[model samples]
Target chain A: MRIETKTEKFDEPLHLESGRILESFELVYETYGELNEDKSNVIVICHALAGSHHAAGRYANEAKPGWWDKFIGDGKVIDTTKYFVICSNNIGSTFGSTNPLSIDPSTGKEYRFKFPILTISDVVRAQMKLYDRLGIEKAVAVIGGSMGGMQALCYSIEQPDFTDTVIAMATTAYTRPWAIAINKIAIESIRHDPAFKDGFYDPDDLQAQGLPGLAIGRMAGLIAYLSPELFNSKFGREYARTDGLYELFGRFEVERYLEYNSYSFPKVFDPLSYLYICKTMNIFDAGRNKDKLEDSFDKVKCNLHLISFKDDMLFFPEEMEEIRDIMIKLGKQDQITYKMVDSQSGHDSFLVEVEKFEDHVRDILKGK
Target chain B: MRIETKTEKFDEPLHLESGRILESFELVYETYGELNEDKSNVIVICHALAGSHHAAGRYANEAKPGWWDKFIGDGKVIDTTKYFVICSNNIGSTFGSTNPLSIDPSTGKEYRFKFPILTISDVVRAQMKLYDRLGIEKAVAVIGGSMGGMQALCYSIEQPDFTDTVIAMATTAYTRPWAIAINKIAIESIRHDPAFKDGFYDPDDLQAQGLPGLAIGRMAGLIAYLSPELFNSKFGREYARTDGLYELFGRFEVERYLEYNSYSFPKVFDPLSYLYICKTMNIFDAGRNKDKLEDSFDKVKCNLHLISFKDDMLFFPEEMEEIRDIMIKLGKQDQITYKMVDSQSGHDSFLVEVEKFEDHVRDILKGK
Candidate 1:
């Protein structure tokens, strides 16, 4: 099915966790299928870092379908024909959402550094507001992977009655040091760019330079998203252009792949939005304010499904298992389901290699 | 033993693999213990990336000893009393050696881009020249770890009669795609820094700026050199100073660790040297110019010992095992031995945790 993004302006002020007010904003989102009589078939999809609200279906002139098109279209895994799907381009995201580049009403300039730092809760709350406006009440499920998965779990914790089910894939309850280290490197890559000028860089400069800073971070993130085994298999020790081996700056096939994929990122993405969103992801902790992590989920009343890939280097299998064991230890085993997909695709498997774990998701979501 | 670095100038022209000539250069090196009458007790140590010639002994007024001081002392594993140790700072490195920042006699200016790109073979050849001048006919052994391991293995492959023993630790025979990808990211991290200015920037600027470019790459490399488990264990999810969590740049303990370690690097290290050395490391292949990898070791006469750490994420145990299997396939099993140390310290374990693998090295070197 063909789908179009819809932008709805929200005049209501959003009170963030940091006590900063987002006065006027717009939520860019998309929906699929019809709302059944009582609207029990609603499903909200949370996008990961660097992902857009475009979860499924193809736009008119797009070469490829939405990021999760294969799993959300008619007769697909989520079966848009049966369930109405809504995905909001999160605030602090560059995909037509109110972000760092969006103009502030107080002054006629972009928010830039003035944009309040965000938490995962702020992102979840913004989506919640969008859901409230869309007449989405007590939805069937909240499904997400990676940072999106954090949001999925957050929805259950913050508003236990918001969704009947929560499917979190390839993510952790709290950020680990390794993940934080990599993220810090990515942030530094952007900041060290002289053109960045402390987040006040001109859009034209990025348009011309093609995101030399963000490109480095993007390549790093892309590499982290895939297993080293997958990297070795996909692009072995072969030169894309081998004039000589001892030559300086010889191009490897993998280097070429990274360049090709990240070339167009800067043209469409705002660097400030990237910086702010990364901070949101970096500081995310589901257990904050609660004495124990188990206490954070004590009031949770939704069926929780933990999905992971064995080769996911970013959020490895052990991390996902820890969350599963925690839920089981908290005596919530009856409402929790855990599945590990044996794919060599790494963290990207949650989005790209869905076929490997679709059966598990179907069994949980569709009662198959 | 107390030691001092000695610099020897060589007027003879050196032919590089790139068909470039380095007319005049200096080799700065350090040695421990007295050479035997026959000079047969010589044990040459090849340094890894960012390492100095001082492998053992404390310099006057220095807070710490050499990088591998623990492994080599009067009665230590390598046994300075029995074997004379020599470690030469490679040509492309910083520490008082001829490098990219050194003045070129032809142009009377810093070599910078004029400095030829180096290979593992080229570095090994330079060390051979240094040995020739030092009146060392043949060494009892050549030992190294990480990039040094590549040189140790290269010594066996390049010159079959150079040494009796070649102990290589925590390294790869050939740089793989995963490694190349990371090296590319590190290169980009430096090159993208606007202050880098194509390696033409003034030294004072680097001193003043404290090498934001190199710092970013160094941080990335530091993280890669460590295992995730080690990082988690050493610096958990605690903030260094958490006044508030939602603050944009609230530092994690790991972040503080990276900043602290990398802060001192720029003052002692040259960014240009780092760039060229990383390139040398990136293109290293012990099997170069061979019909097969096994063919490269066909001429090796040394008792080769391969040492690895189980948790080395950078050069994982699998890569080291592959080389051992290759040696066995070449029918050199009797001449080759492999030992893997069960240390969770990752690639840096070779420098930091010698205790874990000292017994293996002692047995191989001392023929116990």
Candidate 2:
């Protein structure tokens, strides 16, 4: 499979949830397969935090496949053979999208902290614009997991009739306090780093000098993404050998794994973009101003499918169950389907348990 | 009950686990109530990580009581009325002990990273010396929780006949990989702080410049000390108001709580001391050089009482159950008692669920 990223510029001013306007922005997206004459086969795939528009296939210079390469190939679950799939980088992300690292056309400098805070709705609005540019009047489905799942839900509500189906996995309609606390700590870690310099550090020095803070934040996030059962089975009391001395500076295997992730993340992610994206996630609540959650769901006209992992500590199955019960109470049970994936990978199960996800996704796509 | 701290200097050298030796050292301890003539009614109360010799009562000019004031006063669970209590600051702690911040008698400067890494056994050895200085041949009991509980277990094994009873709470005989992983990340956070300067920062500038790293470490530790149920019940989705707006800089109540703890911790703790003590805890496997855990317990000459919290994520009840089963297999069940405290406070339940701990502790003290 081959993949190429393309960009589109929007000269129109876009209002943000922070009440500020982005004068003009650009979107980076990738498409798999061709759009049909009717465009009814179009499916928008949303990426999660730290993810990019490269959702499937590999670029010429890349060493690894795209983030969702396991599922979005020519014959995979979100098969390109039958569906025209579009995955775009979110506005506040550090990928090819217009993010804090991008230059401000008006100021002739990088936006950095000057970038307006984004909400889930703002991200959805940008992707909706991309849909319009491609002449996709209605999508067959909007599919995503975790933060991406939040965007899928927002797409269903923001453009009620544009998406015929919504597939959300390992996410909640409202961000919980537990998640907010974790995200706040992670952002604080980056802010406290002397190298961060209030998010105005030299772009060239950011990744090198701010690697420690970024890595620590990533390490904390990794712990939350994994389950105790997984950790126990994967690295239980296993010590790394250092110079044949396991007692001196040797660490547990899990520590080394976390260290590797923490170090490499800064190379690809902008610290300021990470803070902005996580803050957006912290404030994401579809029912923020509504009287009840049902009132917020009332705007979602698409048929809904919710999938939660049984071992996911972050987005628990109970939370998904609550959403199912709420939809049933709203007399929308006929339009809703809820399924739980029994996995040991915790919140990362959505990405790791390909077999379980594929079986359900294939059935849903077949309209069974 | 009145309590006072005292220090004893030893001119002789002390050997450490890292094959290093301190030329001279000092031990700081606090005593509550008078010791009996026979010295048989004495009980050594150990403090956990970041805790101090001030285990009970309020010091002059202080606004807050000791960490365990609720359970170690005149008529409290430890009962100073009946038993003489001694609480010593651990060897590698900043709380009036011979720690990294202590002045080296030879160099006339702080030890800093030059201080030898300590083991749980080394901490117990120092406390044992304190007992010898007080002319106590044997103690009625050695009681502690968390890291302190590790010390209590070490005391029972190192000097089996010196303590008649051991009460360890919310701890394990062997450090689990999960705990080692959390502690490693915490230490890494401190090491990443530029102000730390490889543990050689100016003493005067440490608390102010190195606070970010120390606070981040403390914040991470605080998360493990609490449980999900506790967070749900205490904070839920409650938001903190910022300038009458819950949207701009709004935070969860839990985030505010963690921020407060992170800010205040650096004021009293030495970042280097935190790293050393946490490392000591990470390597604190009572069964470390032994063929089996039972081999390590074979030396125990005292009755053992183990208490675990039902919700402790760090030291799971299953770990305690494993220890109990080992003792039963060794035919020492008659001398061992295991109890679980049903609480949602997680690892902190040993401190918060006072009534439950008190009941079990009092019964063990009464030899019931």
The interface root-mean-square deviations, each candidate in sequence, come to 1.5, 2.7
User: Per-residue alpha-carbon lDDT of model 2 for A182-231, expressed as tens digits?
Assistant: 67667778887887787777767865554678888888778878877788
Sequence-dependent TM-score of model 1: 0.96
lDDT for every model?
0.84, 0.82
Number of colliding residue pairs in model 2: 0
lDDT of 1 at B103: 95
Best by TM-score: 1
Clashing pairs for model 2 are none
Native-referenced DockQ of model 2: 0.47
Error of 1 at A34 (Å): 2.0
Index of the highest-lDDT prediction: 1
- Cα lDDT, model 1, residue A98: 92
Those runs of model 1 whose alpha carbons end farther than 4 Å from true positions after fitting are: A242-244, A289-291, B289-291
